[model samples]
Target: MKWSMRIVMTLTISLVIAVCLSLLPKMDSSIGINSPYHWPSNRIGQVTDNNLPDLLVQVPLQMRIRKVELSSTRMSLDLSLPKNADSTSVYRDLYTIAQTMLMKTKNVNQVWVRVIDYSGVSDNASTQLVLAMVAERESGKDMDKSASELSLIQLEQELQNRFRITYTSKWQQRYPL
Candidate 1:
């Protein structure tokens, strides 16, 4: 009878532990809705008006997102930045935003980010395309290609090869490998 009681107690303790472990994920705040954990959604390419903002807010954009256009294999983000914003940071923000979007959308292989700034007085208010970047995920063929081929290759070089500055000559010159 004592052995039987011990067995029942052990089983009950094991069951209680299993139930608590199962609830751990739900109790954790790390995966809250405000976070960017909702990746590779089943409805990726089928983006609608309701989900676009949620998708974009995943990244800490340096500027305000003006518009976003999604296609079967591509995502395009048009953003507006303050005229006095730092050029170097904005340049880096381009890559950061693209990477997050690409990772979040399984079907999206390419991401294009455009950042525009406003200038001139009210009468002559003008918008200037200050910076832009285009990034493409690794191709099937490139997957087999080794980065070891280049002796001096670095992470920045590898990232540069994957993503590139576009639309603005001045930014392309200022930003480098």
Candidate 2:
């Protein structure tokens, strides 16, 4: 009888330990601690109302666009105009393009443009442009993308053509949002 009691106690203790180990992960998730089921840092979330930067990179441009920043209500662009191009005309064209592209959706209210002139600056001199674009958030529906995704080759070509500036160049933090 004592041997039987000892066997029964050992089984109960093992079962209790197994149940507790199984419940540990669930308890961690419920309490908002580090959980195994949580999303990894590299995993992209759903395309929500905050994916303006992704959209900006897809916009077609004639000149070399350095940087783009967008928010729920405002958008900004930094462009490096060619030495031969007219700065005023380039600015007007870029501003119009940005305004039209962004204002088509009800979410954006304003667009800002900054033209960076890298004509005579020394190799060590800074050529970063400073500009800010800010707008109040509006309650509106998101924009729809009916077009299919571009191929890797097409994307690479677009990047090579659009971004003439090197990746090591410094860019100003212009957008407030």
* C-alpha TM-scores of all predictions: 0.55, 0.36
Q: Name the lDDT value of residue 90 in candidate 2.
A: 45
User: What residue runs in model 2 are displaced by over 4 Å at the alpha carbon?
Assistant: 1-60, 87-92, 120-125, 128-177
Residues 1-91, model 1: lDDT tens digits: 9999999999999999999999999877556643444433334433444556666766666678877888878888888776656654564
* Worst-scoring 10-residue span by lDDT in model 2: 139-148
Candidate 2 lDDT over residue span 10-91, tens digit each: 9999999999999999897786533323322333222223444444445455567676676655556667756565423443
Residue 88, model 2: Cα distance from true site in angstroms: 6.9
Q: Candidate 1 — which residues are off by over 4 angstroms?
A: 1-49, 121-125, 139-159, 167-177
Q: What lDDT does each candidate get?
A: 0.62, 0.47
Clashes of each: 0, 0
